[model samples]
Target: MKHVYGTTALLVATVALTGCGDSDAGPMPGMNHSSSSTPTSAAAAYNDADVRFATQMIPHHQQAVQMASMAGYQATTPEVKKLATAIKAAQDPEIKLMSGWLTGWGKPVPTPSHGGHGGHEEMPGMMTEEEMSDLGKQQGSMFDRMWIQLMIKHHQGAVAMAKTEQANGKDPASIALAQKVQAAQTAEIATMQRLVGQLPVS
Candidate 1:
């Protein structure tokens, strides 16, 4: 009876140890499963083209925002001021959205050049430093005309970039954003053209 009791005690101890081991092991797999799947799923959804689109478009939109900001104080025409407000409102969020994409993709987010163009002047529809400076100096109807013209050119550049992304981008979200940019900027360009005709020559 003594030997039998000792054997039963040993068996119970072994089962308890095994149960403890399983309980400790259980959470590790779940932790790893969650951590690994999230990044993989996000990374898999984008490709290099999507990264490029996000990277380039961030600064591009920043410049547009800068241009729009100038209208707040300098523009005399109500229509130009309204359009500028709209441009800033639309592009500011887009800049943030693309920046978020770059962060998620493990890509570097482009910093805004502030008053400068971040050396992207060669890009479609980007204004040179001189042009932007000149626009800044103007007020009244001259500012209105110049702002409309430059904004039209800027929108054209954005549309061109969006088109490139639409053609080559792999991520559905990026492509959808590209389509949105294309449609919105194209419409803005038409509106600017009409405004330019109505405004007197600066």
Candidate 2:
């Protein structure tokens, strides 16, 4: 009958349109959206904690690198020099890593305030300019002792910050990096403390 044919046609068209609508609606239900246009990963969900961790830690690591660089000429002890080299190697790459994260997250990387090169004071565990200047003036055994003491404090500060990141960060990458920081710095703190006891009182 004409009526039956018309109803069948209408049902077919309705089914076709429904199929098209579903196809256009994006990935199928339960599909991993990360593979498609929507990035539903932890890295994409950078929160305030992640941003703060990156911004604050960059300057902290920069100061560590600066202190480590000073050891090449200022440090007299082989152990101190070795530690400094390791610190530089570890922290310089981390700085770059955090910088990349900030850039990818569309957040501004925190630069040194007042155009101060190596703006260490803006963050905790950062050396004051005067303290750095004093350390710079030292050499031989004196440099070795002061460097160990200062570095211990610096590492402690980094550990504290990293712990905060672990507690508060949403981004998986940032939290992972913070865990690394906490472990590495805490170990370094133990090493520096041992070095402090071994060094002759200055």
Candidate 3:
């Protein structure tokens, strides 16, 4: 009976020691028990350039999304439709992503201007009210041709903006996104240039 008690006490002591050791170790580095409930600090670090990149890119992408949506009904060519779908797919998420960054960084998200160019007429690749109206008026093969031309120019502006962000933006996430934008838009620009030639002028 004494041996049994001694063995039981030893087992309990071992468990207690183990538990104490675990307690002393505390939470592992970078590990959070309530991580799901906690907001991540990954976006905590940012700068003026990062803020500007996110702010500017939001509206730029919004316009691109607008243009892409128009291709649904306006463009007659399958390739143009496909390209427009892809552009919308790519830019829409990016707009949300950049908007999130701006919000997290405590920066004000740029509201899209209604009717007019929203004072973004001077912004690279931004279409004026007249240009957007003109594009909207076109249909069938004419829209395909004009959209390809205009989108190519629009993509060029986005690429330029991405390059600037990559060069000047401080946040790693912003810079990485800018690099992705540059490569993707550059490829799309090439595709549009080729597509425009095949589209009928009328």
RMSD of 2: 5.4
Clashing pairs in model 1, backbone N/Cα/C closer than 3 A: none
Candidate 2 residue runs with Cα over 4 Å from true position? 1-43, 112-122
lDDT of 2 by residue, 74-185 (tens): 8988889999999999998888878777776777876545225454555678788888999999877889999999999899899989999999988766777789999998
Query: What tens-digit string does per-residue lDDT give for candidate 3 at 124-171?
Result: 888877889999999789888888888888889889888888888776
The reply for model 1, stretches above 4 Å from the true place, is 1-41, 114-122
lDDT of 3: 0.79
> Where is the poorest 10-residue window by lDDT in model 3?
32-41
lDDT of 1 by residue, 1-109 (tens): 9999999999999999999999998976665454333322145557787887777778778888888899988998888889889989998988877777677777888
Q: What is the lDDT of residue 46 in candidate 1?
A: 73
Worst 10 residues of 2 by lDDT: 32-41
lDDT of 2 at 131: 85
Query: Cα deviation of 165 in candidate 3 (Å)?
Result: 0.7
Please report the TM-score between candidate 2 and the true structure: 0.76
The lDDT per prediction is: 0.81, 0.81, 0.79
* Shift in Å, residue 47, candidate 3: 1.3
